[model samples]
Target: MRVTEVVLSVGIGMLFAIGTFLVLRRDLVRVIFGVIVLSQATNVYLITMGGIQGVAPVVGGHGGHGETAVTDPLVQALVLTAVVIGLATTAFALVLAYRVYEEHGTIDLDRLQGVER
Candidate 1:
């Protein structure tokens, strides 16, 4: 694998690790952020799946022999779609967390779950 691939793979792993840790926290906001992190990691993995290219996949692109080393366009499109969905989901989660905070006056999961008098 290339250096770029190695770095991205390591980054994805780290993001997943951190996200998992955050998701286990007692704060709703932190859990939301963790989900966002996990989404980002998934996006990175998608990008890496496209493979690295030395040139664009166009007519007469590179090598002068009509040869080209283009990355998979479909992966790029998928990553873009994932990014937009991630943004929307993150926004919705934040709104929900905000509403929960307003209603219960706390973002902690334990406090929110406790019976209220």
Candidate 2:
């Protein structure tokens, strides 16, 4: 694999690790940030799967040269869709967290659990 791929892979791994750590925390805001980080990692992973070495998928974009690999448009579309969905999901999660905080007066998972019981 190329250096770029290796670097990106490492980055994705780091993101996942950080996300997991944050998600495991007791704070609701941290959990939401974790979810966002995880989603972003997924997006990066999807983009890397599409391959980095390629010309844009456009008519005559290769400068009238010989056969050349074009980056997958489907991957771009999928990532775009994922970004939109991730945004919506994050918004919903934040709203839910806000409501929970307002009702329970604490965003800490432990405190919330105590209140629930």
Candidate 3:
């Protein structure tokens, strides 16, 4: 594992953590940006996982060194599915947020919905 790759992996992981934290924000705009960040982080993680050095797995060539570095296609597929799902989810969330804004003129959760005593 190269130092650059390690740094990139850590960076992507940090992005995911940051995005997750942003998603927990009460402001709707921050939440929307958080979702986008989360999606990007996931995509970056998938790409990083695919960066291993090895021949294509389909070749089935038995090299003497027997190094087991193969591209992780599964992660790629999972990331692809997740991106699509995230898009749909984001669209729905945006629509809901818009409705809230139309009805209440604000997207702040605490401001829009008062605490019930």
Candidate 4:
């Protein structure tokens, strides 16, 4: 694997770990951060899997070639769509979180769930 890929993988791994930790928190804000981290980490993983190794997708993209060099566009398109959808999900989560806090008066999940008492 290339150095770029190795570094990115490490970073994304860290991000996913952090996300898991944040999700475990009782605060709703932590959960939001966790979701965002998870989304980004997932995108990173998808892009990393599509790595081309010293090659750019377009003949005229970053690594220009006469015409012979080209990565698959379908994977690229799918990644883009996934990113957009992830963003939309994050936005929706934020909205829902705000509403939840408004109704519950506290971001703490433990407090909101009365079964603990």
TM-score on alpha carbons, each prediction: 0.85, 0.90, 0.71, 0.79
lDDT (10s digit) by residue, model 3, range 25-73: 9989888989899888978877776765665666656564767777767
lDDT of 4 by residue, 20-115 (tens): 999898888888989888877887787667755535554445544454545566667888998899889888988898999889887788888864
Q: Pick the candidate with the highest lDDT.
A: 2
Residue-wise C-alpha lDDT for candidate 1, range 1-117, written one tens digit per residue: 688878888898999999999999998999999989988888888777787665555545355576556677788888899999889989999999999989989999988889454
Mind sharing the TM-score for model 1? 0.85
- Highest TM-score: give the candidate number: 2
From the highest TM-score down, the ranking of the candidates is: 2, 1, 4, 3
lDDT of 2 by residue, 11-66 (tens): 99999999999999999999999999999999999999997777788856466467
Candidate with better TM-score, 1 vs 4: 1
Off by over 4 Å in 2: 61-65, 115-117
Local distance difference test, each candidate: 0.84, 0.91, 0.82, 0.79
Best-first order by lDDT: 2, 1, 3, 4
Q: Model 3 — which ten-residue stretch has the worst lDDT? A: 55-64
What lDDT is obtained when candidate 2 is compared to the true structure? 0.91
